[model samples]
Target: MVRTAISRVILGVSIFAWVLLLINPGHIMSMEHCHVSDSGPSVSSLHMLLEMNPIASQLTGWGLMVVAMMFPKLIIPIQHIYARSLRRTRFSASLLFAFGYMAVWMAVGLLMIGVIMGLHLLMPGSYLPVTGLAVIAIIWQFSPVKQRCLNRGHNHLILATFGWAVYRDALLFGVIHGIWCVGAGWALMLLPMLLPSGHTFAMLVVTFIMLSEHLEHPKVPRWHVDFRAKLFRMIVAQIQIRLKEAQE
Candidate 1:
């Protein structure tokens, strides 16, 4: 009961924070600038650090995004951990698991920033690189590798141990889950990263799409039929319902 309540509170806080960040126009502008700078290819790591404000802003922006976007998906796994863990260690294990999970994402965020910096250096003002990234992301959506990663993410193991084993298993589960999640959703995640405008909307859309993918049954990649048709229908139904609500 306590674990369930805690999970609900975490989800509520994450949603509230996400909404707050979405409305901040200034933060959006800063995030856009963080991806690609106007400065030439000569820019260095030291230079980026010297202009620490933007870096800090970028981290804050992405960190909030990770928390908001990833927390809901994490609820089930966390609840599972809480259920299996001893009462005295439940909170500690859960906290470590959450930290381990976010650590992977934070590392990935830095790597993404580095890639964007490289792209800015290479193309300066062209959108071709960003376009290519989007194309790659789209292709990745239908790839067999993505299906494999998604399957792994949904497959959970028994963590029925105690002491250091509990901590170890929790952290290990977090890292493994984080990796599979990134693998499964990197394409959708990249879409907002590449787009300079309407990032808040893009992020929200991507988050919804990623969440939807998890809700459906896992399928292996096949060339003959459209695998995402069900997902598309679900989205259309949601839009229609929202539209009707707005009109009423």
Candidate 2:
């Protein structure tokens, strides 16, 4: 009962954060470049974006984004940990597990920032890199490696049953899950990171895709041509259920 309540709270918080981000019209940091002198290379907008926001502010934005986008998908794993833990340490282990998972994503966000900055420096005023990234994302969606990682994410490891072992296992589970998730979803994630103009919308789409993938039953070599058909069926079923509920 307590575990279910905690999961519900986490899901509610995630939904609330997502809605808040949607309603806020301002960009987290503007990606618009300013011209200092027309004769020389244009000043990079990334520099200004970084200068305008303190590191803490940037991290906060990223953290909120991670929580909003990733937390819903984490519910199952968190519940699993909670179920395996003693009542006294259940919440503590779950909290540490969530923290460990978020830490990996935070590191990924930092890496993405560095990559975007480098690309801005390398190819100023060109959308080629972004386009390439989008292509990569699409191709990665069909890759065997992506399917392998996704499958690994769904596999449960044997966890320890006592004291510090509980905490350690939970944290390690989070780290491993985060790593596999990143590997499986990084390409979709890059779409928003590369294009700031449609960041929110792109992120919404990616989040949906990630959630759908997670909800899928595991299969050996899961990346197949019929994957989209399966996802389509799942989506249709969900919509029908929602509509039926509304009618009732």
Candidate 3:
């Protein structure tokens, strides 16, 4: 049943992601380039847009990016929510959890925009910042700190299943999970924003890395090389199963 739920959710997420990619893919992929420039709209007019729309629009895009890249990682937690909730409340509970999770990431997006603005002031249009961030991401991937964060992300809460407590537990679970996920992927997540071009591709690569890492079992935190290729293995296994079933 959990497998079926995961498959259905994956299908929905894939369709949503493809729709976002089909629409203004660039804006959806790039959250760092939110400022006005000389080649672009006028300062007064841009400032008006910025005041009225930019932040909100960027947050919308950021939310879509998270939906595309991070939702897959939530499958287990979401399944747990569904399993623990009363039949009638499961969907509502999951929605509340997603809202809580998205809330954290939206806050992070605002901070990330500020960081990018600072970088722009220091080195506008330069790849140096992106390259530096990529290096940092690589370092983080192998660090014990990253492992510890990933391990913490695997920790599930003992949910309360009655009254407001059920909703509260679901929301709190999402918030705590989002915090750990941010710790695990913030550096990598920043890469797509820092890139001047190929934002979609960068996002895809980061998503793959994150999904791979999430497949790993929590282990002793230590600096070690871990490619976390279980996702690839799982795909292969699934394909093999399908082929055997076809032959049967």
Candidate 4:
């Protein structure tokens, strides 16, 4: 029941994020709109250190992107967290775990924003950055390091049952899982950011790719490609089930 509720909540949030992105398209976060002031060096430093509005808005959109594209990947981890916690504290433990996970992604989002901004400054309207990122993503997709990260992401640690330890364990588990997730998906995530138009469509495609990849079981790290078409198989199975039900 708890797992069901959590899944529903995560699904709803993911849907909400998608809706927001669709309604406004890239207005919430667009690398094109990210301003690079050609002004005083000292003031640029000040803005870099103190500017909150742009930074805050970027983070907000990045958070939504994370929810939309990444939350589905967390269902298994969330289930594991729920199953391992004490009955009374299961909800709290799961919440902490999610918070910790989001925290890591949020921090990485900041760094990603910086990189995107730098690229924008260097090449304002060119597709060079996007193309370059796509090439890098393809290379990363076949790299042993990415496979190692994917394998590590499947790991679930033992949880504590009492006091602060419970919360600590849950949070740390989330942090560790999130780090692996970042390692596996960062290149793909950046691809969508560099797109000039059709940002939502690009995001959807990237999300599908990432989610499909996550559906795979852990495997030994290797420099090989795996499309992990598990989602397609599941859809086919569901279609067959419905067809049989209709016939009966």
TM-scores of all models? 0.80, 0.84, 0.85, 0.88
lDDT of 3 by residue, 1-248 (tens): 76686658765985697578658654544534344532344555355445543666677777788888898888888887777778877888888888888889989999987676556544657799999998998899899999999999999886787799988988998899999999999998889888877888888888888998898899899999988777888889999999999999
* lDDT agreement with native, every candidate: 0.72, 0.74, 0.79, 0.82
**Which run of 10 residues does model 4 get worst, by summed lDDT?**
32-41
lDDT digits (tens) for residues 1-248 of candidate 2: 86688778899989987876676434453243335222234354445645654455556666777788889888888788767767788788888788878889889988876676556555645678879998887778887788888888896655687868888887888888889889988878777756747788888888888888887776676456534445567779999999999999
Q: State the lDDT of candidate 1 residue by residue for 8-63, as single tens digits.
A: 87799789868867676445323332342455455563365326436556666677
Judge candidate 2 at residue 46 and give its lDDT.
47
Model 3 scores what on Cα lDDT? 0.79
Arrange candidates by lDDT, highest first: which order?
4, 3, 2, 1
> Tens digit of lDDT per residue, candidate 4, span 53-166?
377777888998998889988888888878887888888888888898999999999999887766655565568999988999999998889999988998988889889999
Q: Mark the regions of model 2 whose C-alpha exceeds 4 Å error after superposition.
A: 1-4, 23-26, 29-32, 36-49, 122-126, 226-232, 238-248
* lDDT score of residue 210 within candidate 1: 78
Cα lDDT, model 2, residue 124: 49
Write the candidate numbers in order of decreasing TM-score.
Answer: 4, 3, 2, 1
Best by TM-score: 4
Please give the RMSD of candidate 4 to the true structure.
3.3
| Model 2 Cα shift for residue 147 (angstroms) | 0.3
Clashing pairs in 3: none
